[model samples]
Target: MENKRKELLFSREDIQNRVKELGKQIAKDYEGKKILAVSLLKGSFIFAADLVREIDAPVRIEFMTTSSYGHGEETSGHVKVVHDLNMDLKDYDVLVIDDIADTGLTMEFVLEHLKAKNPASIKCCVLLDKPSRRKTELEADYVGFTIPDKFIVGYGLNYGDYYRNVPYVFAFVD
Candidate 1:
């Protein structure tokens, strides 16, 4: 499994530091506002957990599982909501947190769906952004890192659910 990785892209320490910075920024931006941190699951859970702890302001957390990729490297261009949030998004400042914005299809689907729920505002925060692979014009409101088009795994991202526990993010060698 170790041999599959080409090289490390972001170390655990590096990611933690960046997450802290993002948390601080989010706290400031949403000061005195009701924040609901909606985590797109199976990938961004780890990031969301860390981020919310860093935020000084009170924040509610929710999880939803939406996928364009079903245990594969590339998306099929079809999004599915495997799990939905339990709470109504009305009046909450919704911050959608995701692992990566690759083709933008998943994010677009999520944002549009949440918009119908009549949230006060909606914004996206992504751990990684690969604009080169974007099929839509959408962009993340807050991006932890803008990476080149690479098949990345680890740090809650995975290859067939195998490498999510890895502490660092890396690309596959072969």
Candidate 2:
């Protein structure tokens, strides 16, 4: 069965605990401010949703879809924005939420694009940080888990579009 080929990485309880902690930290950081939470789509949808719920401050949500131009394991940092932001970036603190900071190219591209709009301030938060595969020096302000270079799925990361709805994270076994 398909279940036999996977090992649990982060359980549902583990994810919930961490997300709660991150939410508290974020809320405390921006205690007197409003946050324009920009969530990178596809892989980040679920994590962003859960994360925002934990924040105690005023949070507004928006989404961006981006894809990196790469052929294989080595990710070329060039990113193409499929959907651009419609928010007025001048009024609030911008927080970019992503599923995983893999190569960092996509995050870098996104940050640069947002910087042009002149937000009050900008920061990145990711559910997983895979520093081993990073091609750029971008660091997330908040990271839930620093994972190894492995094929992980669940909680918004998909395994051929099926395992995304899984409550926890797991690694595929050969």
Candidate 3:
């Protein structure tokens, strides 16, 4: 598996530190508010778990499974929700969590959908932001890292759903 990666982009320690910092910022931003963290599933699960632990404020965690990339490096550009949120989002401040924002289409779709539910406010928090690949005018409110355009895998990011369990993030060589 090591041969499949060109080099490490982020070490496990680096990712941990960044997540902690993001949690602190989030805890401060929504200190006195009702925060409902909607974690976009499969990819962001690991990150969401770690981030929520660092936050000092009370937060409700929910999972929403949305997909745009199906076992491929690039998105299909057609976003679909495999599973929707079960809890009511009305009057709750929502923080949508995602692993990476590559094209921004999936996040846009999510935001539009969640907006209809009448949440108090909606913001995005992403672990990685690939601004070079963005096809829409959307930005994450909290970003852990601004990465270059590369086929990254590991630390909950994957290629063909194989490398997500890797502790560090890496760019696929081939």
Candidate 4:
């Protein structure tokens, strides 16, 4: 990340408020049911943790690590499931959470994989949605922020794995 400059995209307060809203809406949508919160790891960990707490419903958390970018900035046009879910998806309402939906390939792949397990229903929730760069016909059910086609880091997103600790989202400006 050397020589790269960052500009604020979302502040900590902004993320908190939006996450709470998403949580409430999701809770209402899945009323009277417990949901299996499937968080796509490495990037969505922080967001997922905060989101689940705000949601006023019963949520059992799970983490799956999928990769398409191997030490690079762009997607490799393919996805690999580094780690699979431990819980069975059958008869469960699953919420797939991710930090960002950039090319859509990863989320689509993940959805298809989980769908095979016969989950009652599956929906996607992403903290950031970059539809401009989407290479697949998919959209997240809940999006905290719809960002432009900019390389971003922070708020669990990272550049060269360095900015994940930042509490806000920022875009490369230099």
Give all candidate RMSDs, comma-separated: 1.2, 2.1, 1.2, 1.0
Model 1, residue 115: C-alpha shift (Å)? 0.4
Clashing pairs in 1: none
On the 0 to 100 scale, the lDDT of residue 112 in model 3 is 97
Pick by lDDT: 1 or 2, better one: 1
Residues 4-38, candidate 4: write the lDDT tens digits: 67789999999999999999999999998769999
Global Cα lDDT for candidate 4 = 0.92
Q: Name the 10 consecutive residues with the lowest summed lDDT in model 3.
A: 1-10
lDDT of 1 by residue, 58-157 (tens): 8999999997899889999999999998778887999999999999999999999999999999999999999999999898999999999989988889
- TM per prediction: 0.96, 0.93, 0.96, 0.97
Question: Whole-model Cα lDDT per candidate?
Answer: 0.91, 0.90, 0.92, 0.92
Once fitted onto the true fold, the runs of candidate 3 whose alpha carbons sit more than 4 angstroms away are none
Q: Give the poorly placed runs of model 1, Cα more than 4 Å off.
A: none
Candidate 4's C-alpha runs over 4 A off are: none
lDDT (Cα, 0-100) at 89 in candidate 2:
96
- Look at candidate 4 and give me any clashing residue pairs: none
Best model number under TM-score = 4
Error of 2 at 134 (Å): 0.7
Error of 3 at 123 (Å): 0.3
